[model samples]
Target: MIPSFRLFPDSASTVSGEVNGFFICMLILCSLMAIGIAALIIYSCLRYHRAHERAIGDQRRYNVPLEVTWTVVPFVLFVGMFVWGARMYFDIERPPDNAISMYVVGKQWMWKIQHPEGQREINTLHIPIGQPVKLTMTSEDVIHSFFVPAFRTKQDVLPGRYTTTWFEASKAGKYHLFCAEYCGTKHSGMIGWIYAMPRKDYQTWLTQGAAEGSMASMGEKYFHQFGCANCHHFNNQGRCPDLRNLYMRPVQISTGETIIADDNYLRESIYDPNAKIVYGFHANIMPNFTGVIQPEQVAEIIAYIKALGPQPGAQEPSNPGTAPSTYGAQKGLAGPGATSISGSEVQER
Candidate 1:
């Protein structure tokens, strides 16, 4: 049975416990301070009442020790509080290395979430009860906040940048979520619910949600919709790598060294493609889809690559023989990563 108001959600991860403890401590300290201040105010009013007031000489004067003590004590308390809060903040922001990642886009009226497993939701988040879920979120237009009060986690999602928030729900239940910030006219309607379910139930939800147009399928749809095929197709005249199976594949460099095309590499290739030039591709031709594709879509694209079953030999570029010619040496077009790649020779393999 669930209680009416829970101070803390079920503890599933290490940081939640610390967060709960810190929250409780804060509540206790605040309560004590409020009570003490109230009591002192009442006592001063009664003792120093005008009817019973003494002469001017009998009143207290400035005390250097008292002044210093008041200032120093508060300073120390604030510093300690800051340090304690910072520790918890850092731990919560930086999730474990193996934490499962999810992408959330805070829009004007709703929260769009894309699970790593291809499940998508609108204003409803479904997370595994005991798994550490790291949410990489950004706002589409204005500043927004992703908040889950029960889990004691909230993160600002700003446009043109990325921010992350993470938490692990201990017990399986439905919890309320809100956009703690006053965003706009529909801010009140931006409320949502987080469904924390058992691991098996979460898996079942993923499978059920992915029955149609899964992440990979949506990615493929977007890839085609965005006209990526015009320049990325093997038989086409484009100067970019084929989009068949780019993720997790060894990208051969000019120096003959092969580096795995991992997530960072792929992300760089998307927003700032020329950062690391593949052997045969021209960076300038690849447009930065940062503004075009939402962060959620980027995650979907990555998910599609992960689901592509194995990179087949047919997915390899057909223009491998033209590797020596750095197509990126000259500016091809005004695209996101192309500006950097132009006139830059391929340095590493």
Candidate 2:
């Protein structure tokens, strides 16, 4: 179907109307102020021309109340606008507890998306109407922005960092998607569509893609492949912190600071392991996977870590006794200068 157009893109997202309303209010306030100031200037210039002898007559020394009115009124109006914007900003940045998460990778000229259910899409995002969706995005090369004018949401996807944005489709339809940042040669061509379908239809679309493995499953394989499981295991023998049930949990670091073990934290731990050492673990033990782990693989590892934790209303895993899936394969991958991770091999300083 041909998408409808208006002075503004269809307010198809939960925040769309709110953002548009805020923008309209700002426009009206600014325009009125501009016109008022212009009119006042014109009237004062014409009425108080030097040629008018009576214009000099009635020159009041000072008007304290009028000055106060201008100062207080604009201050109050701006403060109100600031508060409204701050609230919306927090709402947009902090995804809901029950939000459905997805991944997006921005490359030179295309968007690569991955659904938790193992579905994949190129340059298009499929979301269910009336449900909150959180997108964890990154750039493979340079910077790119994930923007949907209809949703009134835009977030920059940066290289070597993860940025997130969330939105709920209030209306079902196809909306424009653009990489708001200038990436490369084909930056303008880096465009797509966001399809908001009904719950059932969305589910169907999800199943239409590859159904082989979830992000967590692929992460699990990489966890074994990269030998991360050997050190960050469930047992006490491993010096590193146990990743099980670690998501959304506050972890104390050696610097005496407590930080949430979120996606960025995990990424940092992999990229620069010594940046924030875990409270109890010795510094400089974990090896950096900066150049070794690809962006997609890092996402998978995060997915696996997220899966290790309890979801909403779910119970924690009662048993985590299984050995690292690659305990034996370590000898092969961990060649000459490798850290020991097996039960009797790993020990704290």
Candidate 3:
């Protein structure tokens, strides 16, 4: 019996061929440069050796064309490589707007994955072929890396922040998943498999074990459970900033900095409420849930917030006065020092 070996992993992603081609080009270029230099050194030694003890060597100083050709040729090739690599990088980093959103939480010895449809899996991911899948990943403990060789995609998952990577599987099969970063004693055991199925089969699999409802629905439950709805009311009359229609919108902070309300901003707002106070709002009003809420719960809460799509015909405020703010004297939910501050007064601050 004979064993078969492969020089490269299966190319199962849209970008895998491009990655392989770029890598081969670089390998060939470097290999040829090395071989050419070695051969030239050998040829020069043989051609320029002294024939007799009194032989005088040619006193050539320098060749302008030769020097310029070597320098300029390598420079152009390197610049071309840089441009090609940069374009590939941006394409990989930016996920398509229509890509399916998935969540991943890295912990010691395991990869916990959740789909928008509420399907949960440990150490295994099921994705659809020919459809882009964007993974919003973070770590609960230490730094971890999400790597799929077949997809030619790898992104670092770090604690206290979110990082994303996307891939569209071109082939339908099972591919290996690995935690590229060395984590703990079970680092070698931290492995998984990605099952890329056809669209119909993937949809069927989504319906099988999703009894827990969608992530947004579960997030809504947590929204009320944590009393987030008490202040962040749906009617836009809450004592705190109205959370409705906040996702992916520009938010003006107290420091006059405008930032997009993305997943990372939402996560930071939950864990460290005072980090970036919304404009026309007082700092230290919202309690920090750093120790109270887990990372997965935070993700769910952000999902719920994202599910709160933009309000119809909700125009952006022309000035600070028109921005949503707490008004009149209402009973406060945020314990002791809670008091209703008028929108006009907060704007002056």
Tens digits of per-residue lDDT, candidate 2, 213-313, equal 98888888899899987888765468787776566555667787665567888888999999988766798888888879988788888988877765533
Each prediction's TM-score versus the true structure:
0.67, 0.81, 0.85
Clashing pairs in 1: 253-349, 284-338
The lDDT ranking, best first, is: 3, 2, 1
Leading candidate by TM-score: 3
Would you list the rank order by TM-score, best first? 3, 2, 1
The digit string of per-residue lDDT tens for model 1 on 239-281 reads: 7665443444456643444555555556557777667776656
How far in Å is the alpha carbon of 52 misplaced in model 1? 6.4
- Candidate 3: segments with Cα more than 4 A from true spot: 1-3, 45-59, 310-349
Off by over 4 Å in 1: 1-16, 51-54, 57-59, 213-283, 288-295, 304-349
Residue 328 lDDT, candidate 2, scale 0-100: 35
How large an RMSD does model 2 have?
9.0
> Residue 53 CA error for candidate 2 (Å)?
12
